[model samples]
Target: MHIHENRPGVLTALNQIFAEQGVNIAAQYLQTSARMGYVVIDIEADGDVAEKALLAMKAIPGTIRARLLY
Candidate 1:
């Protein structure tokens, strides 16, 4: 998943959401520019819950997009 934002606390918010969905974040990479922020999260979740988790992530404020990597 890739998250794009321009505000503070987006990462924290994302973590909380993942936790609520029982998704374990195995790895994360973040990049920021003067006008935007990008984050890639590698998660561990069962197939039954993965789609739900991704949709939840996309619903977050400031998240530009979310999708499965594999």
Candidate 2:
């Protein structure tokens, strides 16, 4: 996910979504600047669960984009 606004709670929201969907986060990377934030989350989950989590993540405020890579 790429967050357009660098504010609090965005990462928490994303993590919550993953937790709710029963997705296991294997690893995560995050970088933030004054204007934007970038996150790469490595997860272990079924296809449907991953898709659900991605959808939930996209709904979070300030999320510019979210997609499943590989």
- Stretches of candidate 2 above 4 Å error? none
Of candidate 1, the 10-residue stretch with the lowest lDDT total is 1-10
TM-score of each: 0.84, 0.90
Question: Which candidate comes out best when scored by lDDT?
Answer: 2
Please provide, for model 1 over 1-70, each residue's C-alpha lDDT reduced to its tens digit, 9 standing for 90 to 100. Answer: 6557778878888888789887788999988887778788888887778788777778888888878878
After superposing all C-alphas onto the true structure, candidate 2 shows an RMSD in angstroms of: 1.2
Q: Which is the leading candidate under TM-score?
A: 2
Report clashes for each candidate as comma-separated counts: 0, 0
Residue 19 in candidate 1, Cα distance off native in Å: 1.1
